[model samples]
Target: MSSQLLMIEDDTRLAEMVGEYLGQSGLHVTHRADGKSGLAQLQGPEAGPLPDLVILDLMLPDMDGLEVCRRIRSLQGPAAQVPVLMLTAKGDPMDRIIGLELGADDYLPKPFEPRELLARIRAILRRRTDGGTPAATPALRFGSLEIDRDARTVTVGGQVADLTSYQFDLLVTLAERAGRVLTRDQIMEAVRGRELDAFDRSIDVHMGRIRAAIEADAKNPRRILTVRGVGYVFAKQQD
Candidate 1:
Protein backbone atom coordinates (compact mmCIF):
# COMPACT_ATOMS: atom_id res chain seq x y z
CA MET A 1 0.00 0.00 0.00
CA SER A 2 1.14 3.51 -0.76
CA SER A 3 2.07 5.68 2.20
CA GLN A 4 -0.23 8.61 2.95
CA LEU A 5 1.40 11.98 3.67
CA LEU A 6 -0.18 15.21 4.85
CA MET A 7 1.72 18.32 3.72
CA ILE A 8 0.86 21.46 5.68
CA GLU A 9 2.36 24.18 3.52
CA ASP A 10 1.01 27.50 2.17
CA ASP A 11 3.05 27.45 -1.02
CA THR A 12 0.62 25.86 -3.41
CA ARG A 13 3.13 25.80 -6.24
CA LEU A 14 5.77 24.08 -4.17
CA ALA A 15 3.23 21.74 -2.58
CA GLU A 16 1.85 20.78 -5.96
CA MET A 17 5.29 20.24 -7.40
CA VAL A 18 6.51 18.23 -4.46
CA GLY A 19 3.27 16.36 -4.15
CA GLU A 20 3.49 15.31 -7.77
CA TYR A 21 7.15 14.45 -7.34
CA LEU A 22 6.54 12.33 -4.26
CA GLY A 23 3.47 10.79 -5.83
CA GLN A 24 5.79 9.38 -8.45
CA SER A 25 7.63 7.61 -5.65
CA GLY A 26 4.56 5.68 -4.40
CA LEU A 27 3.35 8.12 -1.75
CA HIS A 28 -0.06 9.76 -1.72
CA VAL A 29 0.26 13.43 -0.78
CA THR A 30 -2.52 15.58 0.67
CA HIS A 31 -1.89 19.33 0.67
CA ARG A 32 -3.35 21.94 3.03
CA ALA A 33 -2.79 25.70 2.66
CA ASP A 34 -2.48 26.66 6.31
CA GLY A 35 -1.73 25.25 9.74
CA LYS A 36 -5.34 25.39 10.96
CA SER A 37 -6.76 23.65 7.94
CA GLY A 38 -3.93 21.14 8.03
CA LEU A 39 -4.59 20.41 11.68
CA ALA A 40 -8.29 20.13 10.94
CA GLN A 41 -7.64 17.57 8.22
CA LEU A 42 -5.12 15.91 10.46
CA GLN A 43 -7.33 15.30 13.50
CA GLY A 44 -10.77 16.78 12.91
CA PRO A 45 -13.92 14.64 13.03
CA GLU A 46 -14.05 14.27 9.26
CA ALA A 47 -10.29 13.69 8.98
CA GLY A 48 -10.97 9.92 8.93
CA PRO A 49 -7.64 8.29 9.86
CA LEU A 50 -4.26 9.85 10.46
CA PRO A 51 -1.77 9.77 7.65
CA ASP A 52 1.39 7.68 7.78
CA LEU A 53 3.49 10.81 7.92
CA VAL A 54 3.28 14.62 7.97
CA ILE A 55 5.37 17.15 6.04
CA LEU A 56 4.96 20.40 7.93
CA ASP A 57 6.09 23.85 6.92
CA LEU A 58 7.47 26.27 9.49
CA MET A 59 5.91 29.39 7.99
CA LEU A 60 2.15 28.81 8.15
CA PRO A 61 -0.42 31.54 7.76
CA ASP A 62 -2.44 30.65 10.85
CA MET A 63 0.37 29.59 13.20
CA ASP A 64 4.09 29.05 13.38
CA GLY A 65 5.32 25.59 12.47
CA LEU A 66 6.64 24.93 15.97
CA GLU A 67 3.24 25.60 17.49
CA VAL A 68 1.63 23.22 15.06
CA CYS A 69 4.18 20.60 15.90
CA ARG A 70 3.56 21.15 19.60
CA ARG A 71 -0.20 20.72 19.10
CA ILE A 72 0.36 17.55 17.13
CA ARG A 73 2.43 16.10 19.94
CA SER A 74 -0.27 17.16 22.39
CA LEU A 75 -2.74 14.88 20.63
CA GLN A 76 -3.63 11.62 22.35
CA GLY A 77 -3.26 8.02 21.20
CA PRO A 78 -1.99 6.95 17.79
CA ALA A 79 -2.62 10.26 16.13
CA ALA A 80 -0.09 11.93 18.39
CA GLN A 81 2.59 9.44 17.48
CA VAL A 82 2.34 10.05 13.77
CA PRO A 83 5.77 10.83 12.30
CA VAL A 84 6.52 14.39 11.16
CA LEU A 85 9.09 15.89 8.83
CA MET A 86 9.51 19.63 9.31
CA LEU A 87 10.42 22.00 6.48
CA THR A 88 11.44 25.64 6.67
CA ALA A 89 13.39 28.32 4.89
CA LYS A 90 15.32 29.07 8.04
CA GLY A 91 18.85 27.71 8.21
CA ASP A 92 19.45 28.35 11.88
CA PRO A 93 20.75 25.30 13.73
CA MET A 94 18.58 26.13 16.71
CA ASP A 95 15.46 26.03 14.57
CA ARG A 96 16.27 22.51 13.41
CA ILE A 97 17.06 21.39 16.94
CA ILE A 98 13.89 22.95 18.30
CA GLY A 99 11.83 21.22 15.66
CA LEU A 100 13.34 17.88 16.57
CA GLU A 101 12.81 18.53 20.27
CA LEU A 102 9.13 19.13 19.56
CA GLY A 103 8.69 15.64 18.06
CA ALA A 104 9.60 16.29 14.46
CA ASP A 105 11.04 13.09 13.07
CA ASP A 106 13.35 15.00 10.71
CA TYR A 107 14.16 18.49 9.42
CA LEU A 108 14.92 19.94 6.00
CA PRO A 109 15.72 23.49 5.02
CA LYS A 110 13.94 25.03 2.04
CA PRO A 111 15.45 25.47 -1.47
CA PHE A 112 16.42 21.83 -1.37
CA GLU A 113 16.35 19.44 -4.25
CA PRO A 114 13.30 17.28 -4.78
CA ARG A 115 15.50 14.18 -4.66
CA GLU A 116 16.87 15.16 -1.26
CA LEU A 117 13.34 15.56 0.03
CA LEU A 118 12.41 12.14 -1.28
CA ALA A 119 15.52 10.63 0.29
CA ARG A 120 14.73 12.17 3.66
CA ILE A 121 11.12 10.99 3.48
CA ARG A 122 12.22 7.47 2.71
CA ALA A 123 14.77 7.52 5.52
CA ILE A 124 12.26 8.64 8.12
CA LEU A 125 9.65 6.09 7.09
CA ARG A 126 12.26 3.34 6.98
CA ARG A 127 13.24 4.06 10.59
CA ARG A 128 9.62 3.69 11.72
CA THR A 129 9.14 0.43 9.87
CA ASP A 130 12.48 -0.99 10.99
CA GLY A 131 11.87 -0.12 14.63
CA GLY A 132 8.76 -2.29 14.74
CA THR A 133 10.86 -5.40 14.26
CA PRO A 134 11.84 -7.32 17.38
CA ALA A 135 15.39 -6.98 18.65
CA ALA A 136 17.58 -9.79 19.98
CA THR A 137 17.70 -8.20 23.41
CA PRO A 138 14.70 -8.23 25.66
CA ALA A 139 13.20 -5.13 27.19
CA LEU A 140 15.28 -3.28 29.77
CA ARG A 141 13.95 -1.98 33.05
CA PHE A 142 15.48 0.61 35.36
CA GLY A 143 13.64 1.54 38.49
CA SER A 144 10.29 2.78 37.19
CA LEU A 145 11.54 3.20 33.64
CA GLU A 146 10.90 0.55 30.97
CA ILE A 147 12.61 0.38 27.58
CA ASP A 148 11.02 -1.81 24.97
CA ARG A 149 13.54 -2.15 22.17
CA ASP A 150 11.38 -4.24 19.89
CA ALA A 151 8.44 -1.89 20.07
CA ARG A 152 10.60 1.20 20.42
CA THR A 153 8.51 2.52 23.30
CA VAL A 154 9.52 4.00 26.63
CA THR A 155 7.41 4.30 29.73
CA VAL A 156 8.56 6.17 32.79
CA GLY A 157 6.81 5.55 36.09
CA GLY A 158 4.29 3.47 34.12
CA GLN A 159 3.46 6.40 31.83
CA VAL A 160 4.41 6.77 28.20
CA ALA A 161 7.40 9.02 27.51
CA ASP A 162 7.05 11.39 24.59
CA LEU A 163 10.14 10.70 22.49
CA THR A 164 10.86 10.92 18.83
CA SER A 165 12.15 7.78 17.08
CA TYR A 166 15.76 9.05 17.20
CA GLN A 167 15.49 9.89 20.87
CA PHE A 168 14.14 6.43 21.66
CA ASP A 169 17.07 4.73 19.95
CA LEU A 170 19.53 7.02 21.75
CA LEU A 171 17.97 6.19 25.11
CA VAL A 172 18.10 2.47 24.39
CA THR A 173 21.74 2.72 23.43
CA LEU A 174 22.55 4.39 26.71
CA ALA A 175 20.41 2.01 28.73
CA GLU A 176 21.87 -1.10 27.13
CA ARG A 177 25.29 0.04 28.21
CA ALA A 178 24.28 1.27 31.59
CA GLY A 179 27.08 2.46 33.87
CA ARG A 180 29.39 2.93 30.90
CA VAL A 181 30.26 6.40 29.66
CA LEU A 182 29.92 7.09 25.97
CA THR A 183 31.05 10.12 24.06
CA ARG A 184 28.65 11.99 21.82
CA ASP A 185 30.37 10.48 18.80
CA GLN A 186 30.06 6.97 20.19
CA ILE A 187 26.40 7.42 21.04
CA MET A 188 25.66 8.85 17.63
CA GLU A 189 27.49 6.05 15.90
CA ALA A 190 25.68 3.42 17.93
CA VAL A 191 22.22 4.81 17.31
CA ARG A 192 22.58 6.33 13.84
CA GLY A 193 25.06 3.81 12.45
CA ARG A 194 27.32 6.67 11.43
CA GLU A 195 29.92 9.11 12.66
CA LEU A 196 28.94 12.35 14.32
CA ASP A 197 29.94 15.80 13.21
CA ALA A 198 32.04 17.46 15.88
CA PHE A 199 30.17 20.73 15.44
CA ASP A 200 26.70 19.20 15.56
CA ARG A 201 25.17 19.06 19.03
CA SER A 202 21.98 17.35 17.96
CA ILE A 203 22.87 14.37 20.13
CA ASP A 204 22.89 16.60 23.18
CA VAL A 205 19.60 18.16 22.17
CA HIS A 206 18.07 14.71 21.79
CA MET A 207 19.40 13.69 25.18
CA GLY A 208 17.83 16.72 26.81
CA ARG A 209 14.50 15.93 25.18
CA ILE A 210 14.67 12.32 26.33
CA ARG A 211 15.48 13.40 29.87
CA ALA A 212 12.47 15.68 29.81
CA ALA A 213 10.28 12.72 28.98
CA ILE A 214 11.67 10.16 31.45
CA GLU A 215 13.32 12.07 34.25
CA ALA A 216 11.54 13.33 37.31
CA ASP A 217 13.43 16.58 36.92
CA ALA A 218 14.92 17.05 33.52
CA LYS A 219 17.08 19.90 34.81
CA ASN A 220 18.80 17.46 37.12
CA PRO A 221 18.49 14.12 35.39
CA ARG A 222 19.38 11.09 37.50
CA ARG A 223 18.90 8.40 34.87
CA ILE A 224 21.27 9.84 32.26
CA LEU A 225 24.10 11.75 33.78
CA THR A 226 26.54 14.13 32.15
CA VAL A 227 30.25 13.66 32.77
CA ARG A 228 32.28 16.81 32.67
CA GLY A 229 34.49 17.02 29.54
CA VAL A 230 33.65 13.42 28.63
CA GLY A 231 30.25 12.20 27.52
CA TYR A 232 27.23 10.71 29.28
CA VAL A 233 26.29 7.54 31.15
CA PHE A 234 23.10 5.78 32.14
CA ALA A 235 23.24 5.02 35.83
CA LYS A 236 23.90 1.43 36.76
CA GLN A 237 21.05 1.71 39.20
CA GLN A 238 18.74 4.58 39.98
CA ASP A 239 18.29 5.42 43.64
Candidate 2:
Protein backbone atom coordinates (compact mmCIF):
# COMPACT_ATOMS: atom_id res chain seq x y z
CA MET A 1 0.00 0.00 0.00
CA SER A 2 1.15 3.54 -0.68
CA SER A 3 2.29 5.49 2.37
CA GLN A 4 -0.42 7.72 3.82
CA LEU A 5 0.18 11.37 4.79
CA LEU A 6 -2.07 13.70 6.82
CA MET A 7 -1.71 17.45 6.58
CA ILE A 8 -3.17 19.95 9.05
CA GLU A 9 -2.76 23.42 7.63
CA ASP A 10 -5.12 26.40 7.73
CA ASP A 11 -3.90 27.77 4.38
CA THR A 12 -6.00 26.28 1.62
CA ARG A 13 -3.78 27.16 -1.33
CA LEU A 14 -0.60 25.86 0.28
CA ALA A 15 -2.38 22.70 1.38
CA GLU A 16 -3.74 22.08 -2.11
CA MET A 17 -0.32 22.51 -3.70
CA VAL A 18 1.43 20.29 -1.18
CA GLY A 19 -1.28 17.62 -1.39
CA GLU A 20 -1.00 17.52 -5.16
CA TYR A 21 2.78 17.35 -5.11
CA LEU A 22 2.88 14.61 -2.50
CA GLY A 23 0.06 12.67 -4.17
CA GLN A 24 2.02 12.65 -7.40
CA SER A 25 5.00 11.40 -5.45
CA GLY A 26 3.09 8.15 -4.65
CA LEU A 27 1.77 9.10 -1.19
CA HIS A 28 -1.92 9.22 -0.39
CA VAL A 29 -2.42 12.70 1.05
CA THR A 30 -5.24 13.54 3.46
CA HIS A 31 -5.80 17.22 4.14
CA ARG A 32 -7.51 19.14 6.97
CA ALA A 33 -7.75 22.93 7.25
CA ASP A 34 -8.69 23.40 10.90
CA GLY A 35 -7.00 22.19 14.05
CA LYS A 36 -10.11 20.94 15.85
CA SER A 37 -11.50 19.28 12.74
CA GLY A 38 -8.17 17.79 11.84
CA LEU A 39 -7.76 16.38 15.34
CA ALA A 40 -11.26 14.91 15.14
CA GLN A 41 -10.35 13.22 11.85
CA LEU A 42 -7.25 11.83 13.48
CA GLN A 43 -9.22 10.54 16.49
CA GLY A 44 -12.31 9.38 14.67
CA PRO A 45 -13.20 5.70 14.88
CA GLU A 46 -12.22 5.25 11.26
CA ALA A 47 -8.92 7.12 10.88
CA GLY A 48 -8.59 5.44 7.48
CA PRO A 49 -5.40 3.60 6.48
CA LEU A 50 -3.62 5.33 9.36
CA PRO A 51 -1.35 8.09 8.12
CA ASP A 52 2.30 7.08 7.98
CA LEU A 53 3.20 10.70 8.56
CA VAL A 54 1.68 13.99 9.72
CA ILE A 55 2.59 17.45 8.39
CA LEU A 56 1.38 19.91 10.98
CA ASP A 57 1.31 23.70 10.71
CA LEU A 58 2.19 25.59 13.89
CA MET A 59 -0.64 28.07 13.64
CA LEU A 60 -4.21 26.75 13.63
CA PRO A 61 -7.55 28.47 13.92
CA ASP A 62 -8.56 26.55 17.06
CA MET A 63 -5.40 25.27 18.73
CA ASP A 64 -1.66 25.66 18.48
CA GLY A 65 0.16 22.97 16.51
CA LEU A 66 2.25 22.11 19.54
CA GLU A 67 -0.88 21.22 21.49
CA VAL A 68 -2.15 19.17 18.57
CA CYS A 69 1.18 17.34 18.45
CA ARG A 70 1.05 16.67 22.18
CA ARG A 71 -2.46 15.25 21.92
CA ILE A 72 -1.57 13.00 18.99
CA ARG A 73 1.41 11.67 20.89
CA SER A 74 -0.77 10.91 23.91
CA LEU A 75 -2.86 8.53 21.83
CA GLN A 76 -2.39 4.83 22.49
CA GLY A 77 -1.66 1.84 20.24
CA PRO A 78 -0.41 2.41 16.69
CA ALA A 79 -1.36 6.08 16.62
CA ALA A 80 1.63 6.95 18.79
CA GLN A 81 4.13 5.62 16.23
CA VAL A 82 2.99 7.89 13.41
CA PRO A 83 5.85 10.29 12.66
CA VAL A 84 5.16 14.03 12.79
CA LEU A 85 6.88 16.80 10.84
CA MET A 86 6.21 20.28 12.22
CA LEU A 87 5.69 23.04 9.64
CA THR A 88 6.20 26.49 11.05
CA ALA A 89 6.90 30.10 10.05
CA LYS A 90 8.54 30.66 13.44
CA GLY A 91 12.22 30.34 12.55
CA ASP A 92 13.51 30.84 16.06
CA PRO A 93 15.77 28.06 17.36
CA MET A 94 13.72 27.92 20.57
CA ASP A 95 10.55 27.30 18.59
CA ARG A 96 12.17 24.33 16.90
CA ILE A 97 13.49 23.08 20.24
CA ILE A 98 10.07 23.31 21.84
CA GLY A 99 8.55 21.36 18.97
CA LEU A 100 11.18 18.65 19.33
CA GLU A 101 10.65 18.64 23.08
CA LEU A 102 6.93 18.26 22.48
CA GLY A 103 7.52 15.04 20.49
CA ALA A 104 7.61 16.25 16.87
CA ASP A 105 9.97 14.11 14.84
CA ASP A 106 11.20 17.07 12.81
CA TYR A 107 10.63 20.72 11.92
CA LEU A 108 10.57 22.52 8.57
CA PRO A 109 10.66 26.29 8.24
CA LYS A 110 8.06 28.14 6.20
CA PRO A 111 8.59 29.04 2.50
CA PHE A 112 10.39 25.75 2.10
CA GLU A 113 10.87 24.18 -1.31
CA PRO A 114 8.53 21.29 -2.06
CA ARG A 115 11.45 19.13 -3.12
CA GLU A 116 13.32 19.86 0.07
CA LEU A 117 10.21 19.06 2.05
CA LEU A 118 9.76 15.81 0.19
CA ALA A 119 13.38 14.90 0.85
CA ARG A 120 12.92 15.47 4.59
CA ILE A 121 9.71 13.47 4.67
CA ARG A 122 11.38 10.58 2.89
CA ALA A 123 14.45 10.76 5.12
CA ILE A 124 12.38 10.56 8.30
CA LEU A 125 10.27 7.68 7.05
CA ARG A 126 13.41 5.84 6.03
CA ARG A 127 14.97 6.23 9.45
CA ARG A 128 11.81 5.10 11.18
CA THR A 129 11.46 2.07 8.91
CA ASP A 130 15.01 0.93 8.23
CA GLY A 131 18.39 0.71 10.05
CA GLY A 132 17.56 -1.86 12.74
CA THR A 133 20.32 -4.36 11.99
CA PRO A 134 22.49 -4.40 15.07
CA ALA A 135 26.07 -5.67 14.64
CA ALA A 136 26.19 -7.35 18.05
CA THR A 137 23.98 -8.43 20.96
CA PRO A 138 26.39 -7.72 23.79
CA ALA A 139 24.38 -5.65 26.26
CA LEU A 140 26.20 -2.67 27.77
CA ARG A 141 25.77 -2.37 31.53
CA PHE A 142 27.02 0.72 33.30
CA GLY A 143 26.11 1.72 36.82
CA SER A 144 22.32 1.86 37.05
CA LEU A 145 21.84 2.27 33.28
CA GLU A 146 20.66 -0.83 31.49
CA ILE A 147 19.57 -0.75 27.84
CA ASP A 148 17.23 -3.54 26.85
CA ARG A 149 16.42 -3.39 23.13
CA ASP A 150 14.13 -6.38 23.33
CA ALA A 151 11.90 -4.61 25.84
CA ARG A 152 12.64 -1.16 24.38
CA THR A 153 13.20 0.45 27.78
CA VAL A 154 16.01 1.59 30.02
CA THR A 155 16.29 0.44 33.63
CA VAL A 156 18.19 2.67 35.99
CA GLY A 157 19.32 0.46 38.87
CA GLY A 158 16.53 -2.03 38.12
CA GLN A 159 13.91 0.71 38.17
CA VAL A 160 12.20 2.01 35.03
CA ALA A 161 12.59 5.77 34.85
CA ASP A 162 9.78 7.68 33.21
CA LEU A 163 11.17 8.91 29.93
CA THR A 164 9.66 10.76 27.06
CA SER A 165 9.35 8.77 23.85
CA TYR A 166 12.16 10.73 22.19
CA GLN A 167 14.44 10.36 25.23
CA PHE A 168 14.07 6.61 25.32
CA ASP A 169 14.74 6.35 21.62
CA LEU A 170 17.78 8.59 21.82
CA LEU A 171 19.25 6.58 24.68
CA VAL A 172 18.73 3.33 22.80
CA THR A 173 20.18 4.77 19.61
CA LEU A 174 23.36 5.80 21.38
CA ALA A 175 23.70 2.64 23.49
CA GLU A 176 23.05 0.25 20.62
CA ARG A 177 25.45 2.05 18.31
CA ALA A 178 27.90 2.24 21.29
CA GLY A 179 31.41 3.72 21.23
CA ARG A 180 30.79 5.25 17.80
CA VAL A 181 30.92 9.05 17.73
CA LEU A 182 27.58 9.94 16.20
CA THR A 183 27.43 13.43 14.78
CA ARG A 184 24.59 15.69 15.84
CA ASP A 185 23.10 15.41 12.38
CA GLN A 186 23.37 11.63 12.53
CA ILE A 187 21.76 11.53 15.98
CA MET A 188 18.87 13.72 14.86
CA GLU A 189 18.36 11.52 11.83
CA ALA A 190 18.45 8.21 13.69
CA VAL A 191 17.16 9.05 17.17
CA ARG A 192 14.75 11.94 16.62
CA GLY A 193 13.73 10.73 13.17
CA ARG A 194 14.35 14.05 11.40
CA GLU A 195 16.66 15.99 9.11
CA LEU A 196 19.03 18.43 10.80
CA ASP A 197 18.98 22.18 10.24
CA ALA A 198 22.01 24.48 9.99
CA PHE A 199 21.45 26.29 13.29
CA ASP A 200 19.61 23.66 15.35
CA ARG A 201 21.26 23.00 18.72
CA SER A 202 18.14 21.34 20.07
CA ILE A 203 19.90 18.01 19.95
CA ASP A 204 22.52 19.25 22.39
CA VAL A 205 19.87 20.56 24.74
CA HIS A 206 17.93 17.31 24.68
CA MET A 207 21.13 15.38 25.28
CA GLY A 208 21.81 17.46 28.36
CA ARG A 209 18.37 16.68 29.72
CA ILE A 210 18.76 12.97 29.02
CA ARG A 211 22.12 12.99 30.75
CA ALA A 212 20.69 14.62 33.80
CA ALA A 213 18.11 11.88 34.12
CA ILE A 214 20.47 8.95 33.54
CA GLU A 215 23.89 10.10 34.69
CA ALA A 216 25.21 10.15 38.23
CA ASP A 217 26.69 13.56 37.52
CA ALA A 218 24.97 15.43 34.74
CA LYS A 219 27.53 18.25 34.94
CA ASN A 220 30.41 15.86 34.34
CA PRO A 221 28.32 13.65 32.01
CA ARG A 222 30.39 10.50 31.88
CA ARG A 223 28.08 8.24 29.85
CA ILE A 224 27.43 10.39 26.81
CA LEU A 225 30.54 12.46 26.14
CA THR A 226 30.75 15.33 23.69
CA VAL A 227 33.54 14.98 21.10
CA ARG A 228 34.39 18.65 20.79
CA GLY A 229 33.74 19.82 17.22
CA VAL A 230 32.80 16.34 15.98
CA GLY A 231 29.72 15.19 17.91
CA TYR A 232 28.92 12.82 20.85
CA VAL A 233 30.05 9.34 21.74
CA PHE A 234 28.16 6.98 24.04
CA ALA A 235 30.68 5.18 26.18
CA LYS A 236 29.43 1.61 26.65
CA GLN A 237 31.44 1.45 29.84
CA GLN A 238 32.56 4.44 31.85
CA ASP A 239 36.33 4.78 32.25
The model with the greatest lDDT is: 1
User: What is the per-residue lDDT of model 1 for residues 1-239, given as tens digits with 9 covering 90 to 100?
Assistant: 89899999999999999999999999999999998888887788649678988999999988999999999989877788888899967568888888888888777888889998888788778767764545476789998999987777899878988788778878988999999999998998776556877877877888899889999999998999999888999997755
* For model 1, the run of ten residues with the poorest summed lDDT: 128-137
Model 2: lDDT to the true structure? 0.78
Q: To one decimal, what is the Cα RMSD in angstroms of model 1 from the true structure?
A: 2.4
Question: How close is every model to the real structure, measured as TM-score?
Answer: 0.87, 0.77
Instruction: Assess candidate 2 and give its TM-score to the true structure.
Output: 0.77
**Candidate 2 on 47-126: residue-level lDDT in tens?**
65678889999989989998998888787766765778999775566777877777787788898999978987887676
- In candidate 1, stretches whose alpha carbon ends up further than 4 angstroms from where it belongs are 131-137
Q: How much is 154 displaced in model 2, in angstroms?
A: 5.3
In model 2, pairs of residues that clash are none
lDDT of 1: 0.86
The regions of model 2 sitting more than 4 angstroms off are 131-173, 185-198, 208-222, 228-230
